[model samples]
Target: MVAPLSAWPWENLGCFKYLLYGPFLAKVLYSRFHDQEASEYSWCLHILVICALRGLIHQIWSSYSNMLFLKRNFRIIEHGVDFKQIDKEWDWDNFIILQALIASMASYMFPFPANLPFWNTKGFIAVLTLHMAVSEPLYYLMHRYVLHGNSFFTHHHSLHHSSPVPQPFTAGLATFSEHLMLAVIIGIPILGASLMGYGSIITIYSYVLIFDFLRCLGHCNVEVVPYQIFKTIPFLRYLLYTPTYHSLHHTEMGTNFCLFMPLFDAIWKTLNGKSWELHKKIRSNLGKSGRVPDFVFLAHVVDVSAALHAPFVFRSFAALPFSPRFFIIPLWPLTLLALLMMWAWSKTFVYSFYKLTGRLHQTWVVPRFGFQYFLPFAREGINKHIEQAILRADKLGIKVISLAALNKNEALNGGGTLFVDKHPNLNVRVVHGNTLTAAVILNDLPKNVEEVFLTGATSKLGRAIALYLCRKRVRVLMLTLSAERFQKIQKEAPVDCQNYLVQVTKYQAAQNCKTWIVGKWITPREQSWAPPGTHFHQFVVPPIFSFRRDCTYGDLAAMRLPDDVQGLGCCEYTMARGVVHACHAGGVVHLLEGWTHHEVGAIDVDRIDLVWNAALKHGLRPVSSSC
Candidate 1:
């Protein structure tokens, strides 16, 4: 009995036909051509040779155009335009190599059969032309739907999208699956024609090569053909495609789906309706800028030179001796190492260059008469004036505290107090008891103290302190290098303390005797002030005190948390005076509860099984059951 309808004959037909067409065609062709007719075969040979040459020339020209477009129009430094939108590397080297291997196989293993009726020279050419016309619409449909569809886009099509404005070289740069799909789609019509005795497979192959060349040309950046001619004659327009139309496909995306003609897109309403408007605008802008197309020509030269020389340059390097001299001496290794280092250094250099230029290009800041402040980095004579102000302040018994040394690490070290050990006279203390403690400490300062100097104050902390001090009617002098750096603090600094936190340079503070008259002065590092009510809830515990349920050690000794956690916990709770064990447990409960209740300090409690158990058994989890 015949197999069920589910077991279709064409299930494995593709694979079987793929294996048969190549060898069968070659044998038939060999049988038909006599030994004496080898010379007469020159006609066929010349045609094939001419076709191949034309395809190659077209590819080269297209590639040149694309390179020019990139070099001239590409905005590399702009945030939205250039490298940010595209991947750092093309990353299609493997895909290209695989395609080359497949093309090579297709070239060698497949030859047209002369013995077959479908292999007749003129008949084959006619059928091949018809096949191309039919296949064009299919190609458009596949490009519009399957390639652009969300399901397959990322895996199969996103690689093409990597180059938003692609070059000609990128035309064939697709995933292997995409290439195979193209081969199947393209091969089917030609195969069908050959089976029906309408065309030679060789003619179909020639058409495919020419099609690839034109496709690459369509993507080229240079305008090889005039837009007016193509726009005027609909049938003739189908013969010659333009770069502008194809480029819009890559640039705007999902707009121009047709390859050879705009007919498909026009029929489907996928054509970019404003293409002409955009073209006119682009031309007008280019004209206003006095831009010429010479840059495009120059870019082509560069691309050609790079392509031709790159192989030789790479081979020369590869041929070098693998010795210490080649590897380490005479700056080769040093040069490579320098280049590697240069990758990061170049970014820094570019940033610095732009910053310098920006500063140089900026208009001078004219000071408002009575409230005049020196420029932040005026190296001429501003230092002496600043020093004199500081001396005057010191003479008035105001203690100058500097918090320059308080880094993030030191802040963590001092139980998140953010105090540095640089100042000997500044009484440093960690008064806040919780994670939001950064604010609480400043709020609860002694009322008798005329001025409290906080050295390491971020904008948030500075804002918090300024707000608190302004409420208490205390003078809070906040000294920094630049007013711009502390602009946030200046804006948010309480209106009452607007004049109190008088920003001054170190030199200015040192110069003025009146600055010393202020009860106490603090000079935090530039831009360190934090606004009022700012909190750091997610305070990390030292590794020694952290217990990970997922991790286990060979012995208990190997599994201990960091010693700093123990030291801080003991010092903050166990070693403090008037510290009850119940209060200590309560503090832990508050910390844990804060983690759950607040978004700022939320902790992952799923792994805190032991802590959860202890808190529950000892009634330390806090009474708010909703948490």
Candidate 2:
């Protein structure tokens, strides 16, 4: 029969065992000798033997696990397993042994007895245990109330979440600040117990070391403990540490904060309820049967569409001005070209519109896109021009006339007549008409009517009429569609007539003011003072208009008629100095300064005299004249 299997293996290793046992037994025997030197020597030798045996056992177990996984084709390397990720890799048993050795050596140097007077062993043990209990609770409270509640959590704790699924070693991979905080917490109790002369410090230190080692073991991703046992003895299971439980904490945060006990988390309710659910889901998804959803098909369609149409939509509007006659020819080539140009133009037009309106205005017919530079449009440019012209009239110490034709078709056909109203000063006359020709009738004013403002003349034909008036040497400001259009008209018009045609778009013409801003105190003395809010505040002022010089004493107080005030004729006032100072002093009637003029030195002396006279009649006093 085959020799006993166990005996066969032991017989071959018997000689090697004897070789190790002989030296160990000899040391033990030598420690009991009557000589102090021999006894000390033996004791040192025995300590080394025990440490070596423990290290051997640890290595054997680790190697056995590795080999078992290898046999099962479950290589940790294949799964990206890393040992450095484990936190707190201090060999607790070995550390304790080394500490003991150092302490023993120190005792010899001091010649102190192991059992010193005043150090009661039993009392020391009790005190040490109590210190640990108190320190743990304090640590928990500090973590919950301070670190987690304040901004510290955002800066410090957030770093840990950088890796959601962490390896074992990552547990101790805290920043230096975090490590220092831990050291303080641990040192407080350790130092307190040591200073109190409680039990043997060595034994107390041993317990602390063991607890720290257990914490490290828990963080390690090794499933050595049985799940069945954990289920059966619930209380004992809570006490025992496990890799799965700790791993869950790393993956799903806000859980498992306690290193030695779960009571702290339970009492504070900080334990994450979803930890178990997340762990189960992660594990199930990692299994062979799990499948990732296919989003590639949908993503491809979106990518292709964006690539094909983005450029076309962006370039269409810019081509509009060049191809004004594009719509006349509906052929694909012309149509395509028109669409492309419009796309480019629209980009700039929309941007400028939003800049002025503070609202994004888009049309379905106009393809939306983003680009640099905004071209002025009929809608925005006309309003802006009128506002500027009004301002200019005020600055030039001249009168303004505003005309509105409600019937667009009739105005275009020259069938409507003009409605004229003089400002309170009778210096500015507003002419409202449905037709350009009707507005042109203002040019036939009597010599005394120094300034004539024509409104409702915004079409191409209206601009031509304004140009004609300019040729006639009348200071004519015309509100048009856009700057681009104004420039085009200027290019085509006679040089002598161009200067007369002040191309104030409708937008600029609407902002003109004819009143002087004054304080409440001066109101009783003057009837021409304005208190603000009479003019359109939302209207955008153009660069050419001068609001400060254009605004009269009556406009600031809203005393001037709206029809007399040009809306879009000027730039915004830098500051309402006349009004601000007067308002502060409670004065209603501030001295009126004459309007700002586009051609300051060129303003007709007679026209200025007439404006001053008109303002005087309106109860405005010219206290001083810079002119």
Query: How many collisions per candidate?
Result: 39, 108
lDDT digits (tens) for residues 1-627 of candidate 2: 332211112234533533434544564567556455543544345344544544444433333332221211211111222112111222223232333344345444432223333345654565556544765666667655654655656656454444333333234444334444555565455345545555343444444455455545554344445545645776754454455556655665557665555566667786666433433433333443321111000000011122122112211121121222333343445545544664454421111000011111110112221121122243243233333333333343433222221111122212111111111333332222112221212222334322223332344334444444555576555454477766765665578757755654433342342211111122222222222332111111111122333233222211111121211111112212111111111111111222322111111222323443444354433212211
lDDT of 1 by residue, 1-627 (tens): 432221222334533523433443354356456554533343244334433454464446533542321233322111111222222222322223333334435434343333334346765665556555776678788888988988677666776677554545457556656766666655655555555566564665566666666766665554455445645764765444456667788777879888677777777898887555444434334433322211000000011112221111222221222112332344454444533453333221110000111111000101111111223343222223223322332343322211111111222223223222222232212112222222223323444545433322333334445545655666655545556756666565557556655565443342322112111222232112322222221111111221223222111000111111210111111112111122123223333343232111111222233333444443332311212
C-alpha lDDT (0 to 100) for residue 50 of candidate 1: 39
For model 2, the run of ten residues with the poorest summed lDDT: 293-302
Q: What are the Cα lDDT values of the candidates?
A: 0.38, 0.34
lDDT of 2: 0.34
After superposition of all CA atoms, the RMSD between model 2 and the true structure is 31.4
Which has the greatest TM-score?
Answer: 1
Error of 1 at 592 (Å): 54
Error of 1 at 605 (Å): 65
